[model samples]
Target: MADPWSKKNPFLSMMLSGANAWAGIARGIMSGQAKGQQAAAARQGNKQVADFWTSALTGGTPKRPRTSKKRR
Candidate 1:
């Protein structure tokens, strides 16, 4: 039996292929953003934990960071 729905039409086949490529690109972009967000959240959580430990070690007094003053 001959397949009537074969990809004989070049235009339709190209359109379908283009759509599939676009969908894959979109999925990759979304996954990348999600990974970035997860990384950011993990960094923030680690900072919070470090701050808590610093405070605990310093008897609840968080030390202020020293800044350089410009001489006039």
Candidate 2:
């Protein structure tokens, strides 16, 4: 009592398989892009914080660290 029209044919099966593969690839690409953006934002934030602290400690402008003079 199986319906002949409901049966899976080769072309239909191939198309469905291709669609699934495309979906999986898209998901992977989207997740990787999100992760890369997150990492970049974190790096930018860290740099800003470091700059702020450096300027604050150095009295507005950053300066080179003082080196100790050796005895002659």
Candidate 3:
């Protein structure tokens, strides 16, 4: 006779395995989202620093300034 409490029951074993699988999938998704957000924040910070240095070196002047024609 097979014990009801044991993993001998196919239905009970399948249900338990399915629950564990779902939990693992959920954890993976959450972890991936967190990593993506961190990477995005790092990229934004690097871009800001680059912009600051460029402006400081260039004295905040436009690359091409418009010249108005002088009428006599």
The number of the candidate with the highest TM-score is 1
Model 1, CA-based lDDT = 0.94
lDDT of each: 0.94, 0.95, 0.92
Q: Could you report the Cα RMSD, in angstroms, for every candidate shown? A: 5.3, 5.5, 4.5
What TM-score against the true fold does each predicted structure earn? 0.71, 0.67, 0.66
Ranking by TM-score: 1, 2, 3
Tens-place lDDT per residue, model 2, 1-72, is 999998879998999999999999999999999999999999999999999999888878747898799779
Clashes by residue pair, model 1? none
After superposition, the stretches of candidate 1 with alpha carbons farther than 4 Å from their true spots are 1-3, 62-72
Lowest lDDT 10-mer window, candidate 2? 58-67
Error of 3 at 38 (Å): 0.7
**Model 2 root-mean-square deviation:** 5.5
- Tell how far residue 14 is off in model 3, in angstroms: 2.7
Residue-level error in angstroms, candidate 3, position 70: 15
Model 2 pairs in collision: none
